[model samples]
Target: MNRAVIVAAKRTPIGKVGGILKDFEPDMLASFVIESLLHETKVSKEEINDVILGNVVGPGGNIARLAALTAGLPYHVPGVTVDRQCGSGLEAVNLAARLVQAGAGDIYLAGGVESTSRAPWKVEKPTSLYREAPHIFTRARFSTEEIGDPEMGEAAENVAEKYNISKDKQDLYSLKSHQKAVKAMESGRYLEELVPVHLLTRTGEKMVIAEDECPRKNTTIEKLSKLKPVFRENGTVTAGNACPINDGAALVLIMSERKCRELGLVPKLCFIDSAAAGVDPNFLGIGPVPAVTKLLNRTGLSMIDIDLVEFNEAFASQVLASLQLLNIPEEKVNVSGGALALGHPYGASGAVLVTRLMIEMKQKKARYGLATLGIGGGLGLASLFERIEE
Candidate 1:
């Protein structure tokens, strides 16, 4: 297969649930990032062959197609929408690389977007089982098996319990995440990848949301310890340790080496390998362990060979568990902070993490970087990128 390389990657500043981007729709947010990418790279609209978008919640229209048109891309360009929960963004990138490697497309845009502020509140219709079995009022059998999807918070709590992770340990990890994120921000490490988004306020005032608004600047172990668990009464997964709802979008341009040379574009990172694994749905948060192992084995590289790692911080416990299971060094993981500090815009998280990883590797002059994430419904996805030196 021919090699595929990333020519450019960019992301809008992650906004908190009620922050500057709260009013923007997911498609609109995606369009903004895509437009910025085209302008920065000076790539013409007609050059793009395909646009792949990742979205977790919204109307079920063809978001990628709509986003492409919304961003002023040529109407002739085809688009596809993908959904792999939190891994959607990264999966889109992986798919785009495959297309280029197969010589199916010369240029592609892959990314994800989420607008939690506009997330639709799903209301399920009452099923026959629920209506007929009114007497079965227990929590375990309240609804039909097919209709009873547990919330992420409950799934995280289950993972914590199964792994025997303590609440104090999670709290401590969360505190470290915030501290590291604050340090990264204070040093302006994220400035390179984060595009400043000018948004309108509630009263039509313009404002720029440049910095991440989720990381608790004053977060401490003591402060986190006082918060109650949101999933279970005695659960370890608390609001302080879990990724918050967020709004953002991230995009990456992938093309074959020949195509980049033809366009006089510098290839930044070469795609190495990507893998996705499935596990028990109840332990969904720990899905990354097997996925990363498979990816490393396939590439004939050990965890130590990876110079940088961006494992989406879905929760402190899940992240800690995945690291311990993979025998990955903590120091090599999320050096610039993660979702806990930045924000986790579910559909856009995977691509966002990969973009951050690329920027971090470039800044540190690293050789290899790993971008991985645990997705909802017991799935894990990972991709390896090698810095392309001139």
Candidate 2:
């Protein structure tokens, strides 16, 4: 029984799909963060017990190992990759903490990475003899056909309809998300934890991407109201309310509390506990309700006990529905914006939430922070962290 704590966290600026980060491969993006984390923490590669990462749609190899080697870590260090879809990154960090608590590792690097622009197009072998061509799949199935599977956007629409979340409310919430994110960016709230990404363009010029590409400083509700629904006919879900496909990577340095003391490093946040839950695929966006409930029950805490919440805003409708059901005030969630404004880089988004939660809890001088997100295929993952009193 050892305690696990997060001593450092860093992430690259999120880029819109086929935008600033499109040139970098998924492994390259991950390697940059790995190198930056090692440099920032001044931790030797030999001390790393393992490197774990979550990846959604990369070339089907163990990317954690690939990125670790690419970052020039010693060959002796091992790496493993996990895939829980959108929750992959947060789950990776949770796994690291559990390993630390079990006395299995002293120091670990865990997080997630995703490059929608670079993800390979998956093609399944043709099952019928009549069709020899391989069939393409945009994503993996969350459940079997018997249980019902819906597109992420369609699922959000279902939640909105079932929960009576209005289109106007969703648009208003989305507008505020953009406003808050723009404010945070302008005030340099995101600068300290962001790692600048360096790129070499096809024109042979060097470029450095240091700012997030998703936040819009001039977004307006009038503009949002004019947009048409994208998921269902007369549906409330729209591109304006849903997170855009994005590219980025985030990583955290986790170590046992004793190891932090030995290294003379003060941890910013202590890993309290984690929980996960499954729900009906049709209302996939409501996944966070049960997961957060389970977490509260396990920790003997309530929503009022949390000072800050970083719930992934996959869609304004889904976020609104889940928060309302959980009795979490809208003002306490995503105070500096969320995936709606920052963009959602699939596997990397969960780790990004945790990264924001840690930094924000420190800035606000808060005690408890919760990072949670609804998965694509009816799953939700939540992690609770307590800020260390300095």
Candidate 3:
């Protein structure tokens, strides 16, 4: 049996939709982090067994292979792309670890990338032969019509209503997220894991995007309280309480424990285990509860045994509901804020959580860290990690 360990992780600064990263291609964004990881770990591309990446909305092609080639890896290094909606990135890492355990490969580069601004327009084929035009499809169907697939915002409303999470609570949680993110940014805590993207202006001037662009330093509960619901007229979920569309890429270098030791590479976090679960699509926000519960139970651990948690903040209501159901304190999760303030780049958010968790664990000198998130279509995924002692 082999253990998978992460030796290096890096991510591009998240950009708001139509923001600084809009002009960059998804493959290029992913390549930047891939190149950075290789440089930081001093690893050769020839040693990589595979490249895996998660992507949601982009041009219809294999982005992992495109990114690997863009990053200048050899032709022999094959790449594959995975799509599990918001859980895609976490699943990619999980697959990489499983491959290592299966003795299929020793080294793997795995993560995710998303560029909402550049996502191509999609259309569904006409249902009838007589129909001449295709209908625009904003998102892919996650469930059959019979099963009832609500928009993510509507699902958040369902979770809030079912779990008694109020509008005021959601607003307050979002405010705290912004506050914590502002504090972290001010202290330069995020710089350690960030890889700057250098861009050229139209005038040939150079520009460097090195910091996240979405955190509001002066966010207030008053402002959040004033915002109306986006999905329903009387719903609690609002733009203020939900994550913004964003663009970014994140990657981590994973290698077998034996190979990591052989290369004299220091392991940051040892991959312990991973779990996935599905729930009612209407209350999709509660997805993480069962997922995390199964993970802890299978590993013979509890919330008390975990030191830190990174629950993707797709919506404040969902986050609060899931935390309450799991009996996990809010203080133990997202110590430096989450997608509510940092922005969520869809497919890349899960990997971003892992990247942040590794850094937080090292700084806090914690032992166990968990990365978990509720995915689109009522799915939940979780991965557990243990920090390596220096």
Candidate 4:
């Protein structure tokens, strides 16, 4: 058996739907970060044994393989794509770790990419005898009809009502998320991990997209309160509190300890444990609690031992409810911000959140950190990272 460690992590600045990254393919976005990691770590292309990417919606021909070809990796480096909705990215990393731990591979590249702007409108094929319009929906079904696959916003609402979380509390958490993200951006915290994206405009102009386009500098609780609920009439969930449709990509290099030493790459974080759990589809937001509990149990650690946490803020109510149920402090989680402030790009968000924890944990010299997120259909994924003590 072997151990896996994180040697590199990087992401493109998240773009709002129909925004800066709209023209880029999800495969291209993924390749950009993977190439950046290879360059940053000075790792040879031949050293990469596999490329695994997580993606939610797009043209579905194994985007990871497309990325590998686009990035000019050799033919021997194959790619695999996984879809666990929002948990896909972290789950890719988790699977990579397992492979390394089982002595299957020495080096691997795993992460996620999403191009909401480019996701094609999927319409079911119409029979010649059938009626006029085809139902166009890009997202795939969550589960069997008996299990139920409620819309994500509806699940957030269920989480809020089921846990008795109030609208005011949700708004408060949203405000703080914006505040923290704004502060982190102003302080250049994201620059360390951001890979600047370059775009050539239609009119022969060069455009540079460097910062996340979602966080609002003027966001306030008052403004959020004035917004109408989106999921249900009189519901606590609102456009301002839930994640926006976003486009982005992120990648991390995980290598066995032997491979790290062989390449002279300094590992920043080591994999401690990872787990997944599921719940009733309606209350999907609470999924993380059980996933984290399982992860903690595996690591034989407590919340007190976790110096930082990144709970994807799919909805403010969802995050708040989970924190309350788990007895975790808000201050300990998403210290720099979360999906609410940064925009959630579905599959890419999990890896992006993990990158956030890695940077913060290293800066704070924290002992342990947990990165976790709930999926759209009752699933949650959690991964524990231990800072490499210098």
Assess candidate 1 and give its lDDT: 0.86
lDDT of each: 0.86, 0.93, 0.94, 0.90
Please report the candidate that would top lDDT against the real structure: 3
Give me the displacement of residue 376 in model 4, in angstroms: 1.5
RMSD of each: 3.6, 1.0, 1.1, 1.2
TM of each candidate vs. truth: 0.93, 0.98, 0.98, 0.98
lDDT of 1 by residue, 49-139 (tens): 8999898876668789988988888889989989888899999999999999888988999999998888766644456755653343212
| Superposition TM-score, candidate 3 onto the true structure | 0.98
Cα lDDT tens digits, model 2, 1-390, are 898999999999999999999988888999999999889888889999999999998886899999999999999999999999999999999999999999999999999999999988888877796669778998789877998898899899999999999899999999999999999999999998899998878899999999999998988999999999998989998888999999999999999999988988889999999999999988899999999999999999999999999999999998999999999998899999999999999888888998999899999999999999999789999999999987
Using TM-score as the yardstick, the better of models 2 and 4 is 2
* Winner of 1 and 3 under lDDT: 3
Which residue pairs come into collision in candidate 1? Answer: none
In terms of lDDT, model 2 sits at 0.93
**lDDT per residue, candidate 4, 66-113, as tens digits?**
999999999999999999989999988988888999998989999999
Candidate 3 local lDDT, 150-238, one digit each (tens): 99899899999999999999999999999999999999999999999999999999999999999998789999999999998998999
Better of 1 and 4 by lDDT: 4
Clashing pairs in 3: none
Give the residue spans of candidate 1 off by over 4 A: 125-149, 202-204
